[model samples]
Target: MGIFEFVANNIYYTVPIPVYVAVLVVLLCQVFRRIFISRRPSIMESTPLAHKTSDLSHYILKSDSCPALQVTPDTTYSWRDKPQEVPREIKPGKYFLTMNIRKLDPNDYIIFDERFLSEYRERQAIIENVGPGKIFVADPSDGGALDLCEETLVVTVDFLVTRYPSMFRKTERGVFCIDAGEEYDLVTRPWSRHPLEITCLLSGEDHILIRCCDDGTLRVAAVGLVYSLNIDWRSFIGKELGSIHKDAHVPFYESALQKSVDRYFQKLPPDKLISRANWLTQVGPELRNDNFPDKYLELVSTLPGNTITPETIVNDLYIRVERQAMRKLPSTNGVVFKFRVYATNIWDLEQEEGIPRRFADHIRGLPEPILRQKHCLECADCILKAMDFMAEQQEKEKFMNSYD
Candidate 1:
């Protein structure tokens, strides 16, 4: 009352006493909330740095009964959370024409989702059948490659434990994977295999470790890239960025992206974790298709019954998105291009809330180079017609609901 009386008398602009009291109450409530509430850190704040794994050779064991361990990025994901992130990344009315790189949340550096067990088995089968040498290629000449392999092992194990505590318990014996039903003593390799090979089986995710050359170009020193985007991983093992992109048939690298990418790598600090997403369409449902130029040619075939019409495009077309994150290793001075592939049928696009029309528009808006890069040029007409039809139906439904 005294405070209100003082304010009322002192201020030239007279405010009501109740208004003053209400403002005071709101300010007090905000103060209390700030004192009690726990908030996520602001963007400018540093991500919680991962703790290095201790020897743990004789550390006291924590009980696994009720999950004494905790997990972060605790937003639960499942098979239903199909990773066709195109719809989410596409702004409400915005479309991207080029690489839309963004700062990645460190917690989201690796996503161990519902597909863990299935993908683990699938990647393992590839190893047993196709041979590990084909998938996990390492440079015997580069010492940094071995350093990257070891440090990657440590980082991956630490991540699995920290991000998924209950499932991956780190102890004296190494990591105990609940889903894999076995323990991996990768802490001290048994001399049977390399650390990169062990990490290949650790999760479904893949990586290519990049080492900087004295000439300021990034070189692919090693890779455990199994889920193929039609690139021959073997050919890329020793290639520099230019040669790799030339083999990749990567569009606009020399003209548009090479200089910027080179500069980014040189300027990148070990402390920054960044990510970007890229996507394209394929003819088949396979997630690991290494068949390249031929696959693009197959889409344009005019052969009887083989040509994809608007109707058949739904079942035959598959969309694959690679969500990639990169971090420059402080210890190894190598950059880890960590990524995972998520594939879905074209039918899934129509079912997504903001996909059909927006995606169709995005396709229509794509420049020729991007269209060729995405392999959408040959089938663009059929894809646009089909999605535009769906968009029309959606509009009709909205029109019909206006009376209600």
Candidate 2:
């Protein structure tokens, strides 16, 4: 019999309806599994989100095998507190203010660096709202007059004011809230209250302006950077500066800070010189304590150019210093510094087109360092040095193998 006819005849005689139904059910189950049970791609796999913020990808620290910033919430900033004063009332004029609130995850906020502000000058307020730190404001608006109002300001409150009083006391004369239909002539009452004004004006939109509460209130405003006064000062002093590790710690801290400063300068653009100057005053003390005044000042100086030589030196010094510090640490089991170093090196290598493919391949093939291993001070130093040496050797090999 022909194959089709024989099969048809056999099916007609032996095939059961229940058997075919069972087969159909199995196929349907598989289709359903494929539709519902498979894992979807993550945000990183998705199309790049708007690069409207600073490209922090470069700033991300990585190490051989560990994930990013896995430190527990306890070690980081707490976001559980609510603000005591919720800006219940804002009127025209200037004021000094602070909010009490939780520290948001890094992903939730945007960094408003000076370059970012210049790039999107039209949206400065918006950028400021998205940043992680405190901000300063000035108002050109004259009281509540609609035509007289200059700009609409909007500020988002995220943090809570823990120490400061929440209520506007009688002494707080410069601060007042205007009801929807209040009338005050700025020309007449400009000097009636403390000239230091805090204005909440409604032009087309609403904005809150906090003027300088006192003269020379140095507000260190920047995106990405948050003022962290709660750093483990004791741990740093003991481990990074104490007698047991003083020899290594002091030099390491100094070198690291210097490198960070150099890096800050190398990466900063010329137009941001003013902002850098402002930042230096605020962060300079911390940098000096950490032993990196040169790099810090260099960034503050605002020299022009995209040169990588200084940056390279900074990076080398940073690695050396970090390695030395790691050697003094109590333990490294969950430490992230090494992985950050490796990732940074990989990124730098990838940027150079002159690097040979074979050398790159060798680096790609090397096993990543295990981050979970409990890091003793010595172990941390060894791992960091090894990674740095490997990176350097890879670059050397790539250069040697490459054609001119």
Each model's lDDT:
0.67, 0.25
Question: Candidate 1: lDDT over CA atoms?
Answer: 0.67
Between which residue pairs do clashes occur in model 1? none
Per-prediction tally of clashes: 0, 35
TM-score list, all predictions: 0.74, 0.18
The residue-by-residue lDDT of candidate 2 on 102-200, one tens digit each, is 233323211212222122232234324433123112222312111111111001011011111131111111121122222322222222211111121
Lowest-sum lDDT 10-residue window in model 2:
320-329
List model 1 lDDT by residue over 1-404, tens digit each.
69888887877566567888899999999988987654632211211133333332222133222122123624233433554243235433333445577887666766665667788888878778777777777787875576676666666666666666656767666678776787776433232455676666675678888887778989989988777754557767768887778766777777778878877887788667788877787767677874322354574465766754544555577777888888787555678887788876777676676577877877877777767777777667877887788788777777899968
Task: Please identify model 1 stretches exceeding 4 Å from their true place.
Answer: 1-88, 91-98, 188-190, 229-231, 291-314, 399-403
Sliding window of 10 residues with minimal summed lDDT for model 1: 40-49
* Cα misplacement distance, residue 58 of candidate 2 (Å): 36
